[model samples]
Target: MLFLKSNKKEKHFFKKNSMSKKSYEEQAEVLSRAIDIAVEAFKKFRPKDFTDVHLAHFVSVYEGYKNDILNPNYKFRTLSALADAKNDILIYFQEGSGPDVNFFWKRIAEEKIGYQRVNKMAKILKRKRIANRMEMDFVTDCLVAYRQEGLISDEESIMLDKMIFDFQKKGK
Candidate 1:
């Protein structure tokens, strides 16, 4: 029991000590330096021969990064931070010699035909005003993803969300 208590105390001490109390400026400088190093390394050593599978994987990971950075609970949630993140993501897409961002989207679309079909079904249900609760939930999820991706305007997302909320609230 004494050994376990000591071990727990040691773990707590390490965990508490590991957290940095750096000012935002200091943190930003560290992040900027890390980004510069990564960019330089990528430029120096990018693979010359990647396959479609690699491209697909890259795009998938890129989308995940985009989603994460745009999430409401993201660490840097300021408007300026979001604008900078958007610019940084755009730079990554535009600077790479690997593949055009549109090509990635086209390939993704080709790969996600089922997603397309579901989206179409949602649209049809929305038009017909007959979407069930489960369908509305799916539409809400899509709206959240679309809003994060900037595929839809904030106002449009809000309007759709309101409509879905109203529909769900009606218990139809």
Candidate 2:
């Protein structure tokens, strides 16, 4: 006859086994709790401050580039330039028409600014025989992918929803 392990050792093994068998939901909850603690600790250590204009510009540029990314026909070079140009315009909008005022205005005007930019890009694609239906389909797919990937937070998700609704309304 073999001697059995002590109750304490058996209890320890059972605890380890039970922990390893946690369901996906239980694992997710544990991971989320850890993340929450980490975030709180980091927030306490290092806070961040951004200007309102910068925040607005960031949101605008992010949304703009995200829209561009959804376009199947969107050229990478064009997207990069558009993003750079938007940044420059934000600088100009904040810095008050510097020495390169004309250049800044040209970029901003060419890019069409805010909501108009989306419509302009869509029209350009449509004129080139990229069907409106296809573009809308691409946008919807991108939105779904973005949500699934957790790229957009709840507030951002609401914004995207509104943007999609607005786009659909305008398309009709």
Best by TM-score: 1
* Per-candidate TM-score against the hidden true structure: 0.30, 0.22
Clashes (backbone N, CA, C under 3 Å), per candidate, total 0, 0
Lowest-scoring 10 consecutive residues by lDDT in candidate 2? 113-122
What does candidate 2 score on TM?
A: 0.22
1-172: candidate 1 lDDT, tens digit per residue: 7455557779887675454323333434433433333333344444456465765565555455455443436456444575465445444433332434334334435544221112433363457553677666556556655666676677666667677767878987
Give the per-residue lDDT of model 2 (tens digit) for 14-100. Answer: 887666444323433432332233233233333234355645555465445444433324244243444454443343233222233
Tell me the lDDT of candidate 1: 0.49
lDDT of 2 at 105: 41
Cα error of candidate 1 at position 65, Å? 28
lDDT of 2: 0.44
Query: Model 1 Cα displacement at 113 (Å)?
Result: 10
Candidate 1 minimal-lDDT segment of 10 residues: 113-122
